[model samples]
Target chain A: MAATRALIRRGARDLRLLAVPQCGIQADMLIGAGCVRGIEAAAVTMGELGGAPRFNAAVKAGAIEIRDSTCPAIHTALQASEKGVPFMPLRGILGTDILAHRPDWKVQDNPFAESGDPIVLLPAIRPDIALFHAPRADRAGNVWIGRRRELVTMAHAAARTLVTVEEIVEDDLLADEATAAGTLPGLYVSGVAEAPMGALPLALTEHYGADTDHLGEYARLARSAEGFAEYLQRHVLAQDVAA
Target chain B: MPVTRTELLIATIARLLEGCGHVAVGASSPIPGAGAFLARALGGDEMRVSVLGSRRHNFFTDGGRELFDCAAQGRMDAFFLGGGQIDGEGNINLVGVGDYPTLDVRWPGSFGSAYLYFLVPRVILFREEHSPRVLVPTVDFVSAPGVSEEGVWRRGGPHALLTGRCLFAFDRAARRFRLESAHPGESAESVAEATGFGYDAADPVPETAAPDRRMLDLIRGRVRDEIAETYPAFAAEVLGTAA
Candidate 1:
């Protein structure tokens, strides 16, 4: 179908994608679709994003981009874009050249009124769209970040927001009297897609089960250069053929 | 009482981590993980603590649960987080900006700050720097909501800040930051002098505890080794090894 072709083509464009480590299913889909390279994500608990297979392959094949800061790293990138700043400085990675290698990121001098040494500055980040999986949402677009609000920072830093939720509630359910504060109001969000089990490999809190084996498989595939390239060819660029 | 920077950072984290039941730590978070382990060793009743990261087995104990999920679900009591740049309000940045129109500033990646910041009841922030670069009056971008000026998060907001030269805590009632403690070996005057912003100096401040043998051993031996082995950056700092 022409529509399908265009959709695939659009996704194939090279651009930055801020991905959650647990979202391996999306990673598979993206790789299979040839959307992006392997991955360029932050993983605090690397064990959760499958094993060295996927990680190694992505890195070896140059399919993935790695950073030390993790999700907060991606969020900071978006923050720079949203705030129109250059770079923000951080402390955890200071004695190392992690910042230096990331030439795109500038460690700015402290702009505060007083200081002795030079300070690092992190630039603001603004993503095209921040995608997330939610437990509940209202037709009006009000969404509950649920018990795990992993997507909150992404939402704040993203230029636009898209969410796939398990359930849809009444618009009134999003109110303070009805629901507690910390709920994601409707104004900031756009395009609410009802995607059940969307948080696949990534746990969906109390609702769904994670695809652990699948994550492991992905890890295996991404661990080595040859493996990663083969994986991308079969999973991402190859035509979807009947098994 | 004069205290080392490491000790001051640890003590502040220990107090904020006092009542927590379970905490999930990253491989790289030495200060927080060590402090948590010490709290337990010091006869703190909270037993459900674990050191988890990318390589350790069963790191995904809860099926790819967000790192902050345990705290959010009442399963964890406390945790620690770091940032590339921290604002006066305690929001962090870890990503980069581009070269020209928007130079591409690369972020190491985000681990779990998003979920942790929103859900963890007692989220202690630790950064090794105390100058203006590390601590800004206004964050270039807020990767995580510190106070939720617009009311985004319900549970945590950078409760305590442990830095290279000082220690701080948030006044829950006022929702404003207060000086909770000063690191040993340093005076309020030195800390205030080093920091770019101002805090309520009139508030009472506590002294950080010295690092006991047990605590130091665990930190230098257990926590440090694990982190150094897992990440390339920490090998030298934690393990005293060459890359």
Candidate 2:
């Protein structure tokens, strides 16, 4: 969430974000920073940590616009953008209030089927930027996300993809066939920044576990706006990368 | 061994999943995850459980959309869902209470229920809280409807709902819930008093079975250990794995 920190440092605001299916502290931190004006995607929770305080508070206060959605819908929309399609048809969501709320999402008869085969169609989600943190990237900027192909799809669908890596490896990430399959080609990458421990307080699969002690503390502090602002001032803004 | 409430819930989940080939659990579902693990341990090679966030548990390589795709193709047999508000008709509200766009309270929003509820045959609704506020007469919003219209091409929907107080089995033909069993110490009158939604109850609601000694042992040992990998805090709290 270095990009989130950078935005906070630069005092960015009124941005829209997708939880990319599910979001936690990263999204909460941004929401608490008052950077997000709207959000589109599935649930916002701290997972095992606890409630996403800022998100809950924002929604309660009517501070931000919530585009209520399910997980597959978010992915289906991204897939439409990846394929350069206007929209993608998906099963389920019939008679749901979620469909009632989503104005852009449509329900139509499937042309492939006979009569009465209705489906939910989601408009493509081509984001202006897709930012995420990874374990490492090569000099070519090829980032190995292992089997987390959601990042690959995000890069493919977005206008620009920015990556923050723990380190820049000397070896070519895509040169090896095993790593090649999991590597996001630098061609899709707009920029790469090396920020060690960038995923601090958040787990970086195979690299490090989340600092749950720190996260637990954040969970406690983020319960109130003042406490959250204090967290922002102390941990996010004032603290350096190492701290 | 004395069975804790957590152990009882885990065993109940495992028993409910008896015939399933594969069960995929979503975020913040430790009890379900542990129960799935116990099922796999008992049911052997054919039974698969993918605890979504865990690399140690989940076997999918295609990323976030894989679970949805797997369900669409009839590969996934079951899933568990919970809600901020669940009504008598089986509709769940994951969005929030009060008016849309200006809610008095907001949840994290629907995760995969919009799609998964249709694709996975054994869609079990599990909520530990069995309060009138949560078990409502009618949900303020439908994150996913309990039952779709006859014409809608839905493969599956609410099979049953498990709560802290009791279990309610959904009859698709009737489009209503029938009280199955009440948890130990909870009677039909108690469940009714706590529940806002009216449901057909048997003359004498049977007590939900306690966890078998073997099952309790497995939960305290193998299941707890497995769950600790992903939900450490939960394991520590429920399973007492802190040591």
Candidate 3:
């Protein structure tokens, strides 16, 4: 998350962010600080901290383009890219308004089915870059993501993948059979940065819980444009100087 | 028995979820999530409830893709969705109000709402704020249409809409919503006044059932604790549980 923030701070403009719901503080921060120009995800919220104030404010102000996506659509799109497919046929979404809004999405008659039912076809999503925070990484760039396999999919689907981790272990993650299943091979990792507490305010699963009080404060402070600027200046910008 | 509006809404939703083998509640939906948990507790081991972001409640190992895959395969029986604006015809607008591309009010884009609404057999549209402003005549943008075109291969759509003022059952045949019952201290007339769209109302509408002592006990006890794992502040504020 911090690694992505650094990219945004370096004026990576008009970048599209893809993330799972409840894990999009970096995206929110990018949008709030005027870095992101578009986003594609299922949902983006503070998760018990309250609503996503910055994201919501940005949307209300019409400052960014958003592709309202669901978990499956994103996964399917990435899967299509991973498999080198132009599009993937999905079972549901024929009746959804989601299909209506997405001009790129198409409905086609089931080519193999006898019922002649329609199916939703989602285009492949090959992002320019995928950035995330992991629990640990090795010197060889193998990131140990544990059960967060979505990171692997993001790496496979995106042109490049960057990650921040708590620590850099000397041991080969793949040498341990138990850990190999959870490791994203260094082949897919573009860069690795060491940033302990990178996913603060958001949890790193077994490592530490989210800073709910701080997130609550963020939610409250980001409710208005002025407050949001103050929040960005205090938390993100100030933290940049300290880092 | 005295029942708060939140309890009544939960109880009403629980009743709507009767006999479902599995129910999936999305993020930021504490009421439905709690209700599903209550139903699971009442129904015993056979019942499965997956609340997104909850380690104890969710069984998905592959991240966000699992839920959509489960729903598509007919493994999920019920789900809940909310929108910024829901029309009489069951069309939900999660994308902002007014024109698209450049809008007067831009909401967080429509997530996988339309997709799930098409596959999940029992999609309950839920919103706490039931006013004319929200329950509009026609949604400015349809994030998910209430009914699909004939032969669109849709197996699931909206079953009912639960709100603070009343309960509305969706008629797939008519593609319109009908007032089922009103909450205590609210009448059909009040619901009509609050709703922007026309609906078929039952003559002499009954008051929505209150949560009984047993149900209330489960809600405030086990259900509250389980939901708190995913929605800490909501569980604390709504159910008086420790975060």
Candidate 4:
């Protein structure tokens, strides 16, 4: 949340964001700050806490473009980008409006099919930067994400991967083959910062669980414009509200 | 003892998972998660259930896209989807109400529905809100169609539509929904009055069976404990027994 505030303070405007598959506070905060010109994500929700108030309000007001998508489509597009492919073919979405709205996405006949099998082809998503929070990072710049492999994909697909970790460990994350399996090598990372409790309202894989009370308060307070402003004033604008 | 409305919904979802070998419940779906667990409990070791958002339930180490990949390969036998608007033709709209980029109402984005709707054979539409507002004659946008055209390479599509008031079985051959049964309080006439879409109905709509004592016992006991891992609030608030 603090990083988002810093970016907003730096005058980031009309930002086009692809929220890997799903997002919560990051998406909402950006929408609330009026920085997002377009958002392409499978879902922008607070999960059990309920709707993302700002994102919903923004969309209803036609403040931004919504490139509505599904989870696999985003992952497949990112996979294409990482693999240095122009596009990748994925199944389903052929008859849906998500595909219809995306003139950029095309339907093509399967080359391997005996007769014909139409498939949806998604363009590669090459983001300018990938930002995430992790539990641990080594001095060698290796970040251990454990089993959350989507971070690795996002890092691999983007031009630069920026990360914040809860702590820096002495042991090289990639020194052991088993640990290396889950570590994002420094080659793909452009920047790293050690911010204790970086992913606060949200949970890190092994570090901590989500601060549900804080999230619940946010969810309750973010429902209205005045309340949202008060929330921003108290959290994002007033102090260093990292969560 | 009389079954609670939520328990009834869970049992209805469980009944839908009768023969499903692998059922994947999406995030924010407490009922379906409970239902999948109920099915697994009754079906013995043959069934595998994966509830998203639970560290203990989902056994995916690959990444966020593992569920999609599993569905694509026909390994996932069942999945649950809901929509802001579900039309007579079985098209679901999670995007929102109103015109394309400029929308009046926006729910969450199409989270994995576009991809999973086609790949998982038994895709159950499980929106609890059954009203004219939700069961529309035509959706504003098709996040994922309940059916797709032939030669579109779809492995599966909508099997049924389950709502708070009724159960609807999709007819892939006919490209429409058939009224299967009505919930306890809802009659055929009441269901029709509440619905905005046109569908064939049985001469005498059967009452949706309530969870029996044994099933309720399981729900109140094991299922409650299991679902708590994913939805603690839901378990504590709704399913918590006053022992």
Query: Evaluated with DockQ, which candidate comes out highest?
Result: 4
Across B79-146, the per-residue lDDT of candidate 1 in tens digits comes to 77787667666666653333311223333334566446656777788888778767766554445656
lDDT of each: 0.56, 0.88, 0.82, 0.88
Ranking by TM-score: 4, 2, 3, 1
- Name the lDDT of candidate 1: 0.56
Q: In candidate 4, residue B102 scores what lDDT? A: 67
**Model 3, span B124-197: residue lDDT tens:** 99999999999999998877888878877788999999988999999999888888899889998889889999
lDDT per residue as tens, model 1, A66-96: 4433344554455555466765444222322
How many residue-pair clashes does candidate 4 contain? Answer: 0
Q: Write candidate 3's Cα lDDT for A140-223 as tens digits.
A: 999998877788888998899988899999999999989999999999999988899988877788889878787777788877
For DockQ, candidate 1 versus 2, the one ahead is 2
Clashing pairs in 4: none
Q: Which run of 10 residues does model 1 chain B get worst, by summed lDDT?
A: B97-106
- What ranking of all candidate models by lDDT puts the best one first? 2, 4, 3, 1
Q: How does candidate 2 score on lDDT?
A: 0.88
Candidate 4 retains true contacts at a fraction of: 0.94
Q: Is candidate 1 or candidate 2 better by TM-score?
A: 2
Candidate 4: residue A28 lDDT (0-100) = 91
Error of 4 at B168 (Å): 1.5
lDDT of model 3, residue A107: 82
RMSD (Å) per prediction: 13.9, 2.0, 2.6, 1.8
